[model samples]
Each structure stands twice: as structure tokens, then as C-alpha cells.
Target chain A: MTTNKTVRLAQRPKGPVKPEDFDIREEDLADPGEGEIRVRNAFVSLDPAMRGWMNEGKSYVPPVGIGDVMRGFAAGQVEASRHPGFKEGDTVTGLLGVQNYAISDGKGVSLADTSLAPLQTWVGGLGMPGLTAYFGLLKVAEAKEGDTVVVSAASGAVGQVVGQIANIIGCRSVGIAGGPEKCDFIKSEFGFDAAVDYKAGNLFGDLKTACPDGIDVDFENVGGDIFDTVLAQMNPFGRIAVCGLISMYNATELPPGPKNLRNVLVMRLRMQGFIVFDFIKHNQEAMTALGGWYKDGKLKFKEDIRDGGVEAFPAVLSELYTGGNFGKLILKL
Target chain B: MTTNKTVRLAQRPKGPVKPEDFDIREEDLADPGEGEIRVRNAFVSLDPAMRGWMNEGKSYVPPVGIGDVMRGFAAGQVEASRHPGFKEGDTVTGLLGVQNYAISDGKGVSLADTSLAPLQTWVGGLGMPGLTAYFGLLKVAEAKEGDTVVVSAASGAVGQVVGQIANIIGCRSVGIAGGPEKCDFIKSEFGFDAAVDYKAGNLFGDLKTACPDGIDVDFENVGGDIFDTVLAQMNPFGRIAVCGLISMYNATELPPGPKNLRNVLVMRLRMQGFIVFDFIKHNQEAMTALGGWYKDGKLKFKEDIRDGGVEAFPAVLSELYTGGNFGKLILKL
Candidate 1:
């Protein structure tokens, strides 16, 4: 019998997430039943979307119920299995909850190939974040060659992938990140064409300078003033893919939206919002392309892996919203 | 030589237009020379877009420059023609300025068939407003059968035609207007299935009641809070064809955008802006369909023809923003 250290939701967050909002403890693991498998989670992926899930209302997905195991995407190894598809010691990844051990019936679970990357990389670059960037930039924004592609939260997991993909497709990739350090990182490390430091102010002027031909596709992650600035600089018939509004995710009261939506009317822009789940049918195509790019060295990922196991889940998760984490944040179980 | 009473843009207004902004006086008009044709204007179209045209900035088209004849759409008779395409005394409609007489080379001129409809109707239902509604509802919105289509400024020219067209295509039509009289007018006169009076203070509740199955297509004419409320009630994969933003046109300062734009991400809505001119190439298709519907009694047009000719251009145009006009506002010469 194995003791599983797990984190569960205690209460819905009001503004920013607090450590007291989660109840982290140990639980006795049960053996797998018919058509079931047990996974010993190696890492728990901490995402910006987790903050939205902790809120008490309808969203892309249902809110995490209080006192229930916190839902998360995790990479692990199948320890024991009664399922025909999986044998012992098969590396896998899926929505396996925030815990050291996860019980699964093999629904969303996929084999994580160590030869392509590491086990932890499955829940990082090649995971949900990578797929989100793939579908959002290519499918939603319709980024093509000779286009100017701008993405907010550029140093983060999804944004980095979006910029790289834009470069691969021959588009000029401009990233908007906080501070000079992260801005420098995206340009030097991820090969982004240009990086604009949002914290430095002069967003509109800086963005205008970055995109001389004017923005064609905007992968909006951070909303509010940043979005408004980008809106004003959009060329005619531009596409805005509303991937995430990380700036408003933890707000106690609803904040005002982009003040420059008039640009939408004037510029004849198309603004569409989408989630990764919306493209579930095309996940395999995204995975193949992402894996190919990663292997060819055209793509690289920066995983900000934190320590202290499942007990540190709440503390590490808070870093994502505050710009404390520099990359794809993950908690080492 | 004919004496032409014309309204020229004397100066740009700060907010809601003032009559002093125009230099309304008589000018000596010359006869047709070479390929030029002279038109004696009868009716000048008064539209919400006139306010935007008065502003000094980049838009879908150039701003009405100071000292230039106020750009307007008008229907009139060709007094003389040197162009082979048009004959003398031919009823025509085009971008003839807000004047008693206009000289054109017959570039955009379209012949008005009095046998199908009246001459004034050429600048009303069969003109810009009618084509705007037709293209915005059908092409831009892609409104199909079983769609719950909602149009703001329902009693106005474009809104009335949008509702009627939605009905013709087997969709549920909902209209949002200011007062009870206009609300009653849209339902009774334009055949809108439901009418929500936005002046009734409970816009969200009333709109919810009006659109029972959630809005599929939002033909947004009025922006500001009205557009915000409509945005919140949109269904997943909903299409919002932003035909106009009448509420913000006369605003001295820009208002905050929709507070419920989060619904755009949650519901995965696609909001796109478009002008009637964007579909200029498809004008014939729209005209044929609209003319066919009008002849079949499926479409009805109400032209609010205000007397006082070119001098009334500023006052009659003001009525459009203030919601004083009942239908397609037309200034008679």
C-alpha cells in the first residue's frame, strides 16, 4: 500500500489565490480495479488557467469543487494496471489531479515518450500549453508568412511556443513580456524577432516601433491596457485570438474590457476566443507537429520546476499570476 | 448655369455636431464637360456614419475635409450627361455631395428604376442603408435559419431592414430600441419577433427574456452599454457582425468597452466589424435579393423624410444620434 500526498481545494478564492485555500494532506492509495491503472505522478503542471478553475462559476470548464482533489495536468509512470493497453512502468501524462499518486481508467491518458524529451517535458512544452499555442496561432489567428505576429506573456509557456511557431512559419514574431530580463530571454533564447518590455511603459509607441508593417495577428494573453494598445495598432482585417486574459483572472470585481474596441469597428478586425478543448479532435495533428519541431531544435522549452512536492502547490501556483515564475511553471511531486 | 445650395464642412465639431460646423450657401454650378454628368439632387441620406466622417482621423474612408462639400449619398435626376453610361433626365443615385446639384463622371452612379420602387426609395431602402443591412446580416453575420438574430437601433433604417431580412431567412428576429413607441414600431411594422426597450432600465433582464434560446447573431449598430449587454447574452460560437457603433459616434470621450467581454472567451464568440462598402463587389447580389424580398411583400421600408433640404442636413443628422428619428432618415431638397 502506498500513501498518496495530495492537494484538495478548501474554498473558492476571492482575488489572488492563498495557501489556506488548499488542504494538502496524505491519503491511503487504493489498488486499481478492472479497466483501471494507477500512476505515480512525477510532476504537476501549474497553469494560469488553474486560477480561473478555482473561481466559483461557469467557465471553459467547471469550477473545482471545494474539498475535492484539485484537477491538474500531470506527467507520471503507470505503476500498476488492470487495463489491456498499459503494462507496468509505462510513462504517461494526463489530467491526473495534484497528487503524488493518481488513479486512472485510461481516458485522457497518453504515453509520454522519453526518447522525444523527458517525462516532465510532457506536462510542460509538449503538453496543454504547447497545443494551446499551436491551435491558437495557426488555426485561430491564421498566422502566415510575411505577417507580423504579436503575443503577450511572451516568456511564459504558451506565449514562447506561439512566437517560435510564428518564426517557423516565416512570420515576424514580436513578444510582449514584463521587465527587461524576460524580454531579453524571449529574444535571445526563443529566437523571437523582437521583445517589448510592458513594465517599461510606452506600450503603444514600443509596439508600433516593433511592428512597422502593423500587427496582423495578436495572440492576446494579458488583457486590459496591453490589449487596448495592441488594438489601436492593428492593421485592416487583423485577427485577434483571445487565448487568455491573465490580468483579470483573479479579480474580485469584473474589470473594464479593452477601451479601444472601436479599433475593431474601424479596422474591420476579427476577434475570436477559444480554449484547447475546442480543438480536441485535432490534438494528434498538433502533437505531431510540436514533437517534430522540438526534435529538430526549432523549438525549445523553459520549465520553471519548483520543489517541496504537492505540499508547495499553492505557494508555487501564486507565482504564475504575480510574474514570479519566468517560464512554464511546474511543481515537482 | 444652375445655382446649387451646398453644405460644406466648415470645421470639425468637438462632440455632437453643431449647425455652425457647416458652411451652407449657394454656389455657381457649371455644365457637364467631357465625361462629366451634372445631377440635381432631390434627397440626401442622413446616416449614423455621418458623425464618424466628421472626425479628423483614419477610418474606412477619408474624413470630410474642411471647406469640402459634406460627403453624402443622394438620389436625383441627371440634368446633363457627357458620360455614355447615363442619359439626360435619368434617375440616378451615388455619392453625390449634400448639395442641390452635383457634378460626377458617373464612376459610382447607379440608375434608379422607378418601376420597381420610388426615386426617393433609391437613397432609402434600395440605397446604402438597405445594402448595409442586407450585407451585414447575410454576408458578415452569416445569419442562417434557426438563428436568434438581434439588432440594436431597431426602428432605424439599417436595423429595421436587418430584422426583416433575418425573418426572411427563417431566423428569430429580436430588436433593441430606446422607447416604447420605437419598440412597438419594430415589432408591429418591421415584423421583429421580440422588441426590448433599452430605455426600460432592465436591459440585461429584458434582453434575456427577448432572446430565450441565447443570441446566435448580433447585428450591432449601437455600441457602449447596449453592445455590452448583447455581448453577455451571446451563445457559444455566436457571430457578432459589428455593422456600426452609433452610440459612440457622437461621444466626446471614448467610453469603456463591454464589461462582459469575458463572455466572448467563455462562450467562444466571434465578433467581426464590417461596413457596407467592404462588400461592394457583392452589391448586385444583395440588391437583387433585397429587391426580390421587397417585391414579394416580405420587406417593408419607412423613410422619415424631413423637410428643409440641405440646410436641415446638420439638424436631421443630429436626430439619428439622439434617437429622435423613427426610421430611415432622409433629407428632402
Candidate 2:
């Protein structure tokens, strides 16, 4: 008999989630069912989007039901497999929950290789965030050379990739991040043309300097006044890919508007919001392109990994909302 | 020599234009020169777009300079002609200004059949506003059948035509107007599938009932909260054509945002701001189709004409911003 530690949703938090929202308990492991694989969680990705899953509403993905395991996609080593395709010792990735072990029936499960990149990179840079940056910027935003692309949350998992990809496409990439260090990271390491320190008192000034020619494409990840400032500076026919609204995720009320939204008309701009799951058809193309970028050394991948086992889930999850991590917030057990 | 009453810009007002900002005076008309025609102005068009022309900045047309004739388009009779294309007694249209008489070089002027639709109709339904509504909604929005369309200022010139054209294309049309009467006009006169009374309050509730399936196309003329409401109700892949921002035109301060704009991504919606002048390439196609619709009685036209001469220009211009008139607001000079 084997025991596995799993985290359960104790209670749904009204706003920003706390440790009380989760319950860690040990469960007796049962035999794997047909076409099922048992995996010990290695790295669990912490995303701002997790805030939405805790809410009960209609969205791109299903809500995390009360008393169910806290839903999260994780990458790990397979402990046991009764599946025909996957075998023991094979590394895999899937929605493994906040558990040390998971049973997935072939669907939504994927194989991972550290040879391509680091194992954690499979969950961050080259995973959902990278794919999101690739498809959303190229396919949805339709970014082009000589175009000025502005991105928010510039040092985060998705934003870092988005700015780098914009640079790769011969665009003038401008990133808006929390502090000077993150801004420096995008400009120096990611090869972004410019970076704006949004935390500085002079946001409008920094934005103006960072985006001298005006923004042609804005990959919005942080919503609030940042969106408003970007609204005013957009050139004609600018495209904004609505990626995430991280700033307002914990709020119990509707966020204040960007006060200058009507600028969308005078500038002849296209501001569209999107979720990457909608581009399921482009998954292959995304992986191929991103994988190539990773190989060519044109892209920079960074991760802040915390290792403390399953009991660390609550503390780790909150760090994402607080923006405690410099890059992709991931946990390795 | 024929004497004519002319209204010229006396001074540029700081905010809401005042009557003192205009100067009405008599001007002596010169005889027609070669390639120039003398026109007796009959109807002068009053438009919200004129406010944009008052400010010294980049715009669709140059600002009306001080001491110059208050720049405006009008329908008039060609009293004397030296141009080969125009003849005496012919009804002509041009940038005839706010004067009762003018001399034209016959350059950039459109000839109209006054019998088909009155002079005011040429300004409203058959002229700029009409052409604006036709091109903005059809060419810019790319409105298609089965798509749900919502129009702000539903009983006004552009909104009325946009809603009816949506209906003509076999799409569901929902109108947002100021009152019950205008809402009724949108349905009874313009054949909009449904009408929302914005002044009645509960705009979101009314919008939900009117657009049960959600909005695919939004012909935006008014900005502010109304824009926010429509954005919340837009469906995935929706398109928004920004024609004007009447609601924000008279705003002395910054216009507050329509927050929830991030929904543009959640729904994969496209919110675009455009000026009809950008769609010059599609002019021939637009004219041919709209002309056919008008002649076949498939489309309806409306005009709000104030029976006032050049002296009434100041008062009539205020009516547009105040939402005091339905359809296109024009003045008979």
C-alpha cells in the first residue's frame, strides 16, 4: 500500500486566495485503471489565470468545483503505467492537480523531454506561456516587421516570450514590467528594444519613451491604468491582444476603466481579447516555431522554482498574485 | 451684384460653443468667373463632426479658421455658371459654407436630383451622413447576415441607416436611442429588430433583452458608459466600427473609460475605430448598392430639418449635442 499527499479545495475564497482555501491530506493509492498512468508531481505551474478557475462562472475552462482537487497542469515522472502508449519511468505532463500522484486517461496528457529544454521549461517558457505568446502575437495580433509592439507584465512567463518573439519578427518590442530589474531583463537579455518600469511614478512618461513610434501591437496581460495609458498612445490600426487581466484578478469589484478607450476610434485601432485554448488548431505550428526559437538561442527562458513538496502549494499559489517571482512561478517537489 | 447672408467663425470657443462664437454678416457676391459657378445656398448641414473641425489639430478636414466662412457642406441652386459641368438653375452640392451664396470652382462637388429627395435629405440621407453610414457600417464593419448588430444613437442619421442595412442583409438589428419615441422610430420607421431606450435607465438590462444572442457588429457614434455596456454584450468575433464620439464631444474634461474592455479578448471581439474617409476605395460599390436600396424602397431615409436661415446655425448646432433632434439635423438657410 502507498500513500500520496494531495491538496483539496477546502473553501472558495471570496477574493485573493489564502492557505485556508486549501486542505492537504494523504490518500491511499489505488491500481491504475485501463489506459491510465500514475505520476508523481515534479513541477506544478502557478499562473494568474488560476484565480479565474476558483470562481464559479462560464469561461474558457471549467471551474474548480467545491471539495475537488485544486486543478493545475503539472509535469512529472511516471511512477506506474497500465497504458499502452506510456510506460513506467517516462516523463509526462497533464492536469495532475495539486497532488503527488495523478491518474489521467490518455487525454490532455503529454510527453516531455529535457533534451529540448529544461523539464520546468516544458511547463513555462516552451509550454502554455510560450505557445500563448507565439499564437496570440503572430496569429491573433498579426504582428509584422517595422511594427511597434508593446507588452504588459513584460517579465512574466507569457510576456517575456511575447516580447522576444516580437524581436525575432523584426519588430520594435517594448515591454512594460513591474520594476527596473524586470525591465532591464527584457531589454538586455530578451533583446527587446525598450522596457517601461510601470511602478515608477511617471508611467505616462516611461510609456512614451519606451514606445516612441507608438504601439502597433499591445499584448495586454496586466489590466487597469496600464491599459488606459496604452489606449491613448496607440497609432492608427494598432492591435491589442487581450491576454490576461492579472491586476484585477483578485478584485471583488469591477476594475476602473482605461479612461481613454474612445481613442480606439481616432487611431483606427483593433483591440481584441483572447484565450490561447481557442487556437487549438495552431498548436502544432506554435510548438514547431517556439521549439525552433528555443534552439536558435534567439529566445530566453527563465524560471523561479521553489521546492518544498505538496504542503508548499498554498504559499506558492499566492506568490503569483503578489508577483513574487521574477519569471515563471513553478514548484518542483 | 447679389447680396448674401454669411455666418463666419467669430472666435473659437473653449468648450461648448456659444452664439457669440459666430458672426452673421452680409457679403457682396462677385460674378461667376471662368470654371466657377455662383450658388445660392438653400440648406446648410449641421453635424456633430463639425466640432472636430473647430480645434486646430489633425483631422479629416482642416479647421475652420477665424474670419473665414464657417466651413460646412450644403445644397444650393447654381444661380450662375461658367463651369462646363454645371448649369444655371441646377441643384448642386459642395462645401458651400454657412453663407446663403457662394462662388465655386465646381471642384469636388456632387450634383443631386432635388426631386428624388429634398435638399435636407441630400445633406442627411443622400449626402455626408448618408455616405458616412453606408461606408462606415458596410465597408468598415463588414456586416454580414445572421450577425447581431447594435447601433448607438439608433434614431440618428448614421445609426438609423446602419440598423436598417443590417436588417436588409438578414441580420438581427438592435438600436440604442435616447427615448421611447426614438426607440419606436427605430422599429416602426427604420425596421430595427429591437430598440433599447438609453434614457430609460437600465441600459444593460435593456441591451440584454434586445440582444439576446449578443452583438457581432456595433456602429459606435456615442462613447462613454453606453460603449462599455455594448462591449460587455459583444459576442466572440464581433466587430465594432467607430464613426464618432458624440457623447464625449462636448466633454470639457477627460472622458471616463468603458471598463470591461478587456472582454474584447475574452470574446475574441474586434473593436475598431475608423473614419469613413479611409474607405475611399469602396465608394463606387457603396453608392451603387445604397442607391439601389433607396430606389427599390428596400431602404428608408429620414431628415430633421429646422426651418431657419443662416441666423439659426448656432441654435441648430447645439441641438445635435443635446440629442434634441432625431435623424440627421439640418438647417434651411
- lDDT digits (tens) for residues B1-333 of candidate 1: 889899999999888999999999998998989999999999988877788788998889899999999999899999999999899889888889899999998877777776667778878888898889988888878999999999998887888999999999999999999899989988998899999999999999999999999999999988889999999889988999998887886577888888888877889899999987788667667766776777788889998888998988888899887879866789999
Model 2 DockQ reads 0.50
Candidate 2 per-residue lDDT over residues B268-327, each given as its tens digit: 777777876566455446655766677778778777888879998988898877778866
Clashing pairs in 2: A265-B273, A273-B264, A273-B265, A274-B265
TM-score of chain B of 1: 0.88
For model 2 chain A, give the 10-residue run with minimal summed lDDT.
A279-288
Q: For residue B88, give model 2's deviation from the true position in Å.
A: 16
All DockQ scores: 0.64, 0.50
The number of the candidate with the highest DockQ is: 1
lDDT of 2 by residue, A92-125 (tens): 7667887888888756677776566667776778
CA error at residue B200 for candidate 2, angstroms: 2.3
